[model samples]
Target: MAADLERQVAHWLAAARTFRDAEEFASLEAWRAVERDVGAPLRRQLNTVVEELIALGDATAKLIATARYDAAALSQAAAAVQRFRRRYFQVDVTLDFIGDAVNTRTSPVLRAALTTLDRLAVASMVSVLQKANKPVPRVLVYQDKGTGASILRAGVRLWAPGAVMPCAAIKIVRHNLYRPTSLFHETGHQVAHLTGWNPSVGAALAQALGHDEELRAMWTPWASEIAADVYAFLHSGYASVAALYDVVGDAETILHWPIGDPHPIGWLRTALGCAFARRCFSEEGPWVALQRSMETRFPISAADTTLQPLLVRSMAAMPRIAEACLSAGVPALNGRPMTDVLEPARVSPAALSELERTVGAALWTSPHWRETEGIRIVALAGLREAEHPETASVWINRARAWLTSEARAA
Candidate 1:
């Protein structure tokens, strides 16, 4: 059965590639070459398949837009798709199959919900930054984990391995093959990255604002992860909470680290996702309901306690960062704002204290926290402390001294 599935998938991929090549008309000569190479019958068949795939994608979008909240249906569909993709594709064809599924699924309610959430999130971000009319053109929806690793690998191989760059296209890795909400979460990252909306501030916060060790550890890539989470939270609105938890839950079950993958663990990633979701949706209505869902589903822990103060500090500093961007006269892309969208829920001192206690407790015993969330907690704490001038100066001095001492010892 597996062998047969693999053969079918290979044939489909080959046909798809041939169709894609023939369709990409570069010049008159290139067009002629494609025509000569593809022949008439194959070209016709390919075109038909391409059209069918496109129509399928449109139909799927509509289905998601209209479907009622049927968890059982969603779960079943997701599982079925996963089984199909796993059985059919060799070398982890999970992403391509899932992407195709999302593109082809037909749920109008889901589509409508996604559209509404996308608009509100984008509007809020733009409004807060005072760039009210920017045109954020596209949001790619991807399924998480299987696809995420592929994306990370592909990005590294094609662009720069171990380096971050502005991706040309927006792609979403869906949380589940069937449940496509993570599409919105990834869309948030795509929009923010493409627009130059929040990348600089996020980088600066990770670098200049973090503690010495934290800065050293996280300065390279953590900013992108955190920024993506923040954007996902703001743009996803209330629906984002469930989508995020689903992704995290799926990741916890599926993703594994053999040695050197840079991404944090599934649990920590989910915790961060939940924290950001709470910040965005803690207010009222659907957003509030989403927050409650996260609490009930994921359950915050002691490690999360450390995140409280960091979240507060970061949230407080956003306005100032926006002011700095405005002062710098950085041009907005398509009239979008230059500011970080502030979530309405303010971080309380009590919350921060509780978070710290929770993190400390979790760190002491739980392998999950110690191996994963603990690092993030420390990194976040350092980042928070680095934002204050006094603390930053102290940290900088200590870092310089440490570097000098290491050099001498060497």
Candidate 2:
């Protein structure tokens, strides 16, 4: 039994070493490139975890050679190696995601935008976590199918506060330029995963309800969604609101009718989004205009009476909830609103009116457009100028180049 166990240990060590040396899984050149683009601070997190795996293998090998060679000792050593092998697989999975992320890119303009977003988001994660004296939360963004965006966490649970449990994968749509606003919403999820903000926010919402069990019951389901919505607004302003409309503005009443779903009803989601916008910006902005339009389309009478009051109350509390969440001083990370980090150009009324006039004439020429708007605004501008698909695509491509150059300069 001892001999057999020793043989197994040899095999396990060999396997671990093989994995450690493998090139196809995570190439050295690839990681170096990522390190350059993402910076060493974030890259170091992955490298440290990887070194741990290699050290585990070394320890396993040392145990078999130096420790007692009795049946019990061998058996214990073998089991330890096997356990690490399983854990190593988790690390392997994350590396594959990162390796792919390093190599992925689309068009020049869009790729620039995506890369900028990744830098800003990861930098924000590092800054905020450091301020709170917490572990660094490592996040990477990648492209995938579908219209919206989503996040994949590394471990079963995010055990450390502000640590992405090992890493977090942000999957963004490939070509849905108009709805990239969803990226802000997706960033909110990454924020929650890193900070475990949802549970904290949920508790706050429950406490704010003040023993109103019924409202509390309704509020808990939508806490995370609302938090994401509010965060998106802070990050992208009216553009985020516009993106929300593009994605779920036409959602059925049935989708929101189920109190069990994590999201509030479609119209209610718009109302909450608009409400958050109101708190952040003036009363006469694009968000307020969108709120009125949505409310007109889907009034409280459209929803069941039981939900109407709850939805209304939820809207009323949006401002306070948003302020409280931000006051936690972690949402934007680095204590700066996303607007500051993003440095989006605000389109003046004159510029917008001029854009409208140009679009009407089907001459989507890039004017000496001085607005340093974010990618979302540029995308929305392209959509609004849509006289045809080809024209929209051309305009968006130009807009993307402009935004990307501005981001690089910043």
Candidate 3:
């Protein structure tokens, strides 16, 4: 049994060595040549993660060799080697995700555009970490087909591997390729994860909305989504909420709340978004119009008995909920309010209009604008698309052209 286990341990160790550069994983070995590549910082991160796992495998191999012929000792050694093998496989899965993302570069320009836009959103949010002297992770974005966008956040344990995800791997849908405010929402996940914003927001909601037990229960559990939505709104203004409405569909979806799901009901979510705009920007802007539109489009009168009262109560509590998200003191950020870290007024209608007016037509033509204020440009485009229904295609194309060029430039 000892001899058999020794050979198996050797095989596991051998497999781990394949993680080294120019070895079994083509994603790590030839990562740079993969389309335009995920860039230098991510390449370095990939290399570092590979080295650490390889070192762990080496330690496991050394420990197994010292086990000799003792049955109990060999069993312990085998378990250690098994752990090493499992982590080795986890690394493989991570690299494969990166490989898949880069592979999509071979698809339409829209795919690459979504990826670029995602990275910009991530970088914009991660700037908070950089400000606070915290380490930032490299980001990877891939285009996928889905009704909604999602994220595998950085600086957190991955879904299966339990390994710290090295990069913010965001999955943006192909449909919303032009206006991907969902990218900001996903990066908000990373930001909230790293800065401990979710729990902080939860605490704030509990304190502020505790007067109504049902409203407290409904919104408190949905803290993560609320934070992400606020992050999206701060970066993109009314358009983020409008884009959310576009994806969430009819009255059935807007009013339905599934217990234990992290997302609040669509009605509350959109209403809270308008509340955020009201608190941060002008009260009479597109958000008020959006709330009125939601009511008209998905009337509360159609709601069933169970959902009817809950939706009404949730709607009334939105202003307070929005205040909690905006003003929550996060310990990870050294107890600073979210508004202190991320200014909502930056993306307000007046500010976005001023940005365009100041920059002239160069905002669209210049990659510098895409580099410095790409996040706001996406917001401006989405807001313009909402405010001016006729020029929607033009604004979308302008953002698309800038994004495509930025992707190529990167």
lDDT of 1: 0.37
lDDT of 1 by residue, 179-291 (tens): 33344345445445545645564555444444444333432344445455554444333334344544555524322322344454444444444444334333233334443
Please give the CA lDDT of all the candidate structures.
0.37, 0.56, 0.76
> Largest lDDT belongs to which candidate?
3
lDDT of 3 by residue, 338-377 (tens): 6787788889999999999999999987867767888888
Q: Candidates 2 and 3: which is better by lDDT?
A: 3
lDDT of 1 at 187: 46
lDDT at 300, model 1: 38
Q: What TM-score does prediction 1 earn?
A: 0.37
Candidate number achieving the greatest TM-score relative to the actual structure: 3
